[model samples]
Target: MSEINLTIDGRQVKAEPGMTVLEVARREGIDIPTLCHHEKLEAFGGCRLCMVEVESRGRTSYAVSCLYPVAPDIAVRTRSEKVDKIRKLLVEELMAHAPDAPELVTLAREYGADRNRFAREASFCVLCGLCVRYCDEVKKKNAVSFFDNGAVRQIKFVPEVAKNECWNCQECFAICPTSYAQAAYLLTEALAFPGQHQSVKRATKAAARKRVVIPIAPVPMTA
Candidate 1:
């Protein structure tokens, strides 16, 4: 594999072409915060917690290091006043959604973010997509997925299919950043009703359509 040189937080570093800025920074002992990134799973840059300042080709911008690819002549700043500001804001948003999430709680303390800053209705899921991606990519199952888009989006599960096709796999529940009670309730309903669920048809149609739900990657901030 060919190598490329870049500077992360003033430290010169060499990384492979496909290596993401987060991976390179980690390899170089530079810390970048993340919520949806898993070593065993594909890159899912939902959380903007890992935003880093990057300067490449005369343009200086902030990028989510987990999905941002390293290139030659690139310069990265993991911790700066601007970067810290963005990260703190991102953490604050996450706190409002998943106030009880252990990882998120710790991150909030680290960044000196207030949990009640943006607190509203308690939304357990922060839309990190970890459980959804894990079910689709690793387990090769479609038990749960995000329904709709934007602020109205939610995790939809097929009760019948989950009972049969899902085989009671709670892998996603275990890794979920929020409480698993909601998911558990759905599973219970599946077992009790057997074939009664609203999302069954939707699941079938989704499977047939095989719609490719692309993971959201952060774009670099424009100069």
Candidate 2:
């Protein structure tokens, strides 16, 4: 594996030939903010939070560092004022859609996003596709996917069937970048209440009673 020399934040750094800009920056102790870029999964480039200005041969352009491979003589600026402003706006927009997501709200605060200037909408998924990618690429379940068009698209689990394709693996719940799936489940549990499963509750009480018998012959056996 050949190495490539690059300049990041005016500091010289070297990385392997095929390393992404994010990888190189982390190695060099340069912080490049990211949201949808997990180390275990392939870069999906949906959040656009890791955008950085790259210069090569006098050509400068913004690129998502998570997807841009490092190259020799490449120059990268990760924390320019321009990059900060754009990231703040992107965080605000994402928050407006999912206001209840605490992770998104915290990220917005970190980027200095003081206000969400966009209108709110009813949406659970941030469209990061962490769930879909994990299920298909890592878990090999293929039990869920994204569907629909335009503003209506979302991640959906496979239709219920005899095989129980979902397997209740909760991969999507674990991989959700926004924590929306877990929050939704918490809300559902709150709404469903304890009385929803009356039969199960009765059976549990009966089983507890059967396990609590007072053995009359226990003292004789001990003697």
Candidate 3:
């Protein structure tokens, strides 16, 4: 593969041809925040958090770094005043719907976003499409999809059945970048088991996996 020279954050860097701007930045130790992006997954560029100002030849504009391939003589600014402002606004908007999401909240705080002016709305899904993409592109399940349109749109597991059409493999839940899977598991246990309890100690110990020491309140003896 041929090497391409580019300047990221004003530092000269060399990256292989076809390397995305995000890759080049990371190789140079420049941190460009991203959501809806994982090293294990393909670049979707759905989240605009990694937007950077790219100047190539005579033209200059903002591009999603994760999707923009690096070329020779490319000048990329990972963080500019305009980019920071836009990222802050995006984070603020995402937070209004998912205020309790720690990852989202952290990113928002990093960008100095203290408030979400948008009215509160109920939405658990971030619409990253990781689930759908993983299913269709990676796993080839294609059992679930995003249905409806506009504000009513959501990650629909199955159109006909209310329950998930998932293969019971838990890939969708596992692949979700947000803590949706953990939250769902907690809710499911609370509702399904009610007073009955199960311990992760048994599962972890039996499997010889890393011990997950979760606190469990002592059960009072029945009178």
Candidate 4:
């Protein structure tokens, strides 16, 4: 791919043809906040925390960095008064779904986002699609997906395939922003074996081969 030259936060950055603005910023050691972008998975752009101002051909517009590709002569601003306000609002909205998440709490504090500004609902899953993407893209299980729509949307686990396969390979659990899988798996175990749910954790750990721990840094809600 041909390389393109652009300016990010007033610093010249050279990037590949397909690289997104967020990718160029990260490569240039510029910190742009993100939540729905994982290096190992495809960018979803579900959270707008990485919004940046892009000036191309004299017109300036805000775009989600994870989805906006780099182009020649484009000027990108990762942070500004406008960008900060948008990031704060995105953090505040995410807090409603993941109020107690360590990453969410940390970002909320950093952005001065009020976690109590909205009503708190009890749910460990933030519906970030990390687990669903991991299952399909990495694990190739095709067993999990988001079900329903809008306010009622939630992950739908295919019990038939999951009961037979996921117990020994709960790798998706490791990538989840919140460990909602632990609770979900326990319920799956109970349904699979009426009296063996109590032993699910022990059995899973004993059979597990790969244990992935995602490190959270002080950045976006995903950290």
Provide the overall lDDT of each model, using Cα atoms, as 2-decimal numbers: 0.72, 0.68, 0.66, 0.73
Query: Which residue runs of candidate 2 sit more than 4 Å off their true CA positions?
Result: 161-168, 183-223
Those runs of model 3 whose alpha carbons end farther than 4 Å from true positions after fitting are 159-168, 181-223
- All candidates in order of lDDT, best leading: 4, 1, 2, 3
Query: Per-residue lDDT for 75-97 in model 2, tens only?
Result: 99998888889899988887766
Give the Cα error of residue 90 in candidate 4, in Å: 1.2
TM-score of 2: 0.76
**For residue 147, what is the lDDT in candidate 2?**
73
- Clash pairs of candidate 1? none
Candidate 4 per-residue C-alpha lDDT over 67-182 given as tens digits, one digit per residue, 9 for 90 to 100: 99889999999888888888888887777766766777788888889988877655556778877888888888866777765657676566666766787888877776656655
- Lowest summed lDDT across 10 adjacent residues in model 1 is found at 214-223
Which candidate ranks first by TM-score, i.e. highest?
4
Clashing pairs in 3: none
Q: Name the best candidate (by lDDT).
A: 4
TM-score of 1: 0.79
Model 4: lowest-lDDT 10 consecutive positions: 214-223
lDDT of 3 at 21: 94
TM-score of each: 0.79, 0.76, 0.73, 0.83
lDDT of 1 at 22: 95
Pick the winner on TM-score between candidates 2 and 3: 2
